[model samples]
Target: MWIVLSLFTALCEAIKDGLCKKGLQGNNFLVIAWAWKAFSLPFLLPLSFITPVPEYLSLRFLGILALGGGLNILATILYIRAIQASDLSLTLPLLSFTPIFLLFTSPLMVGDKPEPTGFLGVFLIFLGSYILGSSKPGFWGPIKGLFSEKGPRLMLCVALIWSIAANVDKMGIRETSPFFWAFCVQAFIASGLTLLLFKQQKSISLGSRKNIFLLSLIGLFTAMGLISQMSAVNIGLVPYVIAIKRLSIVFGVIIGALVFKEKDLKLRLCGAMIMLAGVFLMTA
Candidate 1:
């Protein structure tokens, strides 16, 4: 059951991210962030009604949720910023490191010592994600860009913030319902804040009916991914679950190549296959 949920979660997240990249093509990052969360808020209403409100909510839990929420919002903003400022080649590789950071931090926070096999799996996942996210013209260029201070720092920040957010989220769920009421609450708050701050740009529109419709669909997929991911972590080991979830990077590469007509499809495909081998090891 957990395995099925995990696969579904990764699939949904990949689709969601693909849509996000599409929507960001010519749109305002802040508006995309706001609109996605706002659209997703209503879907959670049913979940909120069905799940009992957590009665044992602690200051600790609330703090973690708020921090996670803030980081999530930051991640969205920075991701869009990265996409706008840099190539998918540059941005996606930086984003791939989130799980690497999560793996290292998991021990300190959760004290879950992944087995040697688990570490091996994580190494494969990392190599796959990095290769899959890099450019073919010169994979070395993206590697150099990643280390340079000028390239996609915001994306790196997103990776670090989300690593912390993932851990805090795992902890918070232990105290609350797996139905993810905290996510619902945080999304609402974040959307409200986005709307307030970005009101001047309210008049900025997608200008294309198709893009608007597609963006909404992407937002829905993202909501589903978030809900499904919470479900996976609630049931499975955090690092293992997250390591498996990184398979989304492979999906993202395929989407970029096929849907977005990104160049170097052949090379990325090879990298993606390697990444899949990593995912298999992580789950082994």
Candidate 2:
């Protein structure tokens, strides 16, 4: 069930990225980022009221939430910037490195350790990432190209930040229901982003009607994806859930190829398959 939920999260995440990329066509990236969280308020806020509250809210829980939300906001900003700056194909695959970072973060943040097989899964994911980035001249050529580009580097940072945030999320969920945690964290992020947006742009206008509509769609998918992800993490191991969720990279690559006509489809798809195999190993 958790696996199914995580898969749903992946689909919603991929769709959200596509929609966000579309919204970025005409709107400011910050506006799109702010809308990504703010618009989701309508869908997520209500969950706080109906979901069972935690028996007690510890200072520890609040602390984790604050820390996690801060990290998440930073990650969101970097992720939006990375996507806005680079092609979907180049940027999205680097996100596969998140689970690799999690091998270290999960243990330290949540006291969760991967099974022996999981380490092998992580190795496969690493190899797949190398394949995805590698091309032409030689094995090292693609790697050099990857570092030479800004998008992949920004995405790599996003992946590392997300690994920490994911463990913090698991910690928060252990103390409260997934829906409740999602509501609080998202509300915090939205509030912070709103302030940031207002600071940058005098007012928080939705701009043209088409952008409003596009942002609204992005928000809906974002809400669904986050809600599903929080639920899955609450019940499953963070690493396992994240590994599965990384399937979003595959979906993102395919969407990029079809919708955006991104280059290097064959290489990207091959990398995605290798990563998918790693995800399977982690699950097994």
Top candidate when judged by TM-score against the true structure: 2
Q: Per-residue lDDT of 45-89 in model 1, one digit per residue for the tens?
A: 577668767666788877877777777766776776777777767
Q: Per-residue lDDT for 1-284 in model 2, tens only?
A: 88899889989988998898788778788888898988888888888889999778999889988998999899988888887787655676577678888989888878778899888877676667556655333445434536777877888899899999999988888888899999889988998898888888889777778878888898899899999999999888788788878777678778978899877768767878887788788788
Error of 1 at 216 (Å): 2.4
Task: List clashing residue pairs in candidate 1.
Answer: none
- Whole-model Cα lDDT of every candidate shown, in order: 0.71, 0.82
* Alpha carbon deviation, residue 128, candidate 1 (Å): 0.7
Best prediction by lDDT: 2
Clashes found in each candidate (C-alpha, N, C closer than 3 A)? 0, 0
**Model 1 misplaced stretches (Cα beyond 4 Å):** 147-149, 185-189, 192-196, 199-212
Model 1 residue 176 lDDT score: 77
